[model samples]
Target: MTGWLVRDAVAGGLAGAIVGGAPSTLHALLTGRDPLAASYAAGRMVLPSEQRPARLLAAAVLAHGALSLGWAVPIAAATPPRRAALFGAAAGLAVAALDLGVVGRRIPAIRALPQGAQVADHVAYGVVVALVCARRRVRRG
Candidate 1:
C-alpha cells in the first residue's frame, strides 16, 4: 500500500509538472514574452529579491516540483477510478482557486502572473494527476 502510494505520488507529480507547465511556456513563447517568466515568479517566493536569473530559474523549478509532489498525494488518493478526468478537472480548478485566487493574492509575484495561463496550468495538473493515478490502478489490477 505504501509503495503504491509513493509510486502514485511520484508519477502524478511528474505528469503534473509536464502537463501543467507546457501551456504557459508555449503561450509565453507565442506571445513574445519570456518563457521563464512564471518560473522566475515562482522562484521569487523563496528568494524574494534575487536578481540573478540562473538561481531564480533553478529555485522556481525546485519549488514547482516540490509543490507538484505535495499536491499529487491528495489528488491521487481522492480521485475516483470512474470519471477520473472530470474529477481531476474539478480538483484542478479548486486547486487554482486556493493556490492562485487565495494564496496568490498574498504573494505579489504570483498575483502578477497572467491569471488565465495559471488557471489553465492548474487544471492541467489536476487532470494529469488523476489520469496517472487511474492508469496505475488499472495496471496493478
Candidate 2:
C-alpha cells in the first residue's frame, strides 16, 4: 500500500509539473512576463534582483508540483481508472474554487493571477494528472 501510494504520487507530480507549468508559462511568455517571476509572485516569495533565475524557476515548479501530487492521491484512491479524467475535471474545479475563492483571498501571490488564467491552469493540472495515472495503472495491470 505504501509503495503503491508513493509510485502514484511520483507519477502525478511529474505529470503535474509538465501540465500545470506549460500553460501558465506560455501565458506568461505571450504576455511578456517571465514565468519564473510569476511563479515567485504566486508563492509570495520576494524576488530580489540578486536571486538566481534557475533557483526561482525551480521554486515555482516545486510549489505547483507538490500541490499536484497531493491532489492526485484522492483521485487515485476513489475514482475508477477509466473515469479518472472526468473526476479530474471536477477536481480541477474544486481546486479553482479553493484557490480563487478561498486561498487567493488569503494569499496575495495567488490572487495576482488573472482569474481566467488560474482556472485554465488548474484544469490542465487535473486532466494531465488523470491521464498519467490511468496510463500508469493500465501499464502495470
Candidate 3:
C-alpha cells in the first residue's frame, strides 16, 4: 500500500509538472513574455535576491518538483477510482483557489503572474495527478 502510494505520487508529480506547466508556458511564449517567468518566481521563494539565471533555473526546477510531489500525495490519496477526472478537476479548482487566490496574494512574484494561466496550470496538475493514481490502481488490480 505504501509502495503504491509512493509510486502514484512520484509518477503523478512528474507527469503533472510537464502537463501542468504547458498552459502558462505557451501563454508566455505567445504573449512574448518570459516562458519561465513562473519558474523564476518560484525560485525566488528560496533565493529572493539571487540574480544568476542558471542558479534561478536550478532552484525553480527543484522547488517546482518538490511542490508537485507534495501536492500529489493528498490528491492521490483522496481521488476515487471511479470519476477520477471529475474529482481531479474539482480538486484542481480548490487548489487553484488556495494557491492563487490566497497564497499568491501574499507573494508578490506569484501574485504578478497571469491568473488565468496559473489556474489552468493548477487544474492540469490536479487532473494529471488523479489520473495517474487511478491508472495505477487499475494496473495493480
lDDT of each residue in 70-140, candidate 2, tens digit only: 77787565546777778777877787788678867666666676667778778777777777777777777
**Model 1 C-alpha lDDT per residue in residues 6-68, reported as the tens digit of each score:** 899899989898889877887888889788889999998888899799999999988899989
Clashing pairs in 3: none
- Which 10-residue span in candidate 3 carries the lowest summed lDDT? 44-53
Q: After superposition, how far is residue 33 of candidate 2 from its true place, in Å?
A: 3.5
| Residue-level lDDT for 14 in candidate 2 | 72
Order candidates by TM-score, high to low: 1, 3, 2
Judge candidate 2 at residue 98 and give its lDDT: 83
Q: Which stretches of candidate 1 lie over 4 Å from their true place?
A: none
lDDT of 2 at 141: 89
Return the lDDT, model 1, position 133: 94
* Poorly placed runs, candidate 3 (over 4 Å): none
| lDDT (0 to 1) per candidate | 0.89, 0.69, 0.88
**Candidate 1 vs 2: which has more lDDT:** 1
Q: Against the true structure, what is each candidate's TM-score?
A: 0.94, 0.78, 0.94
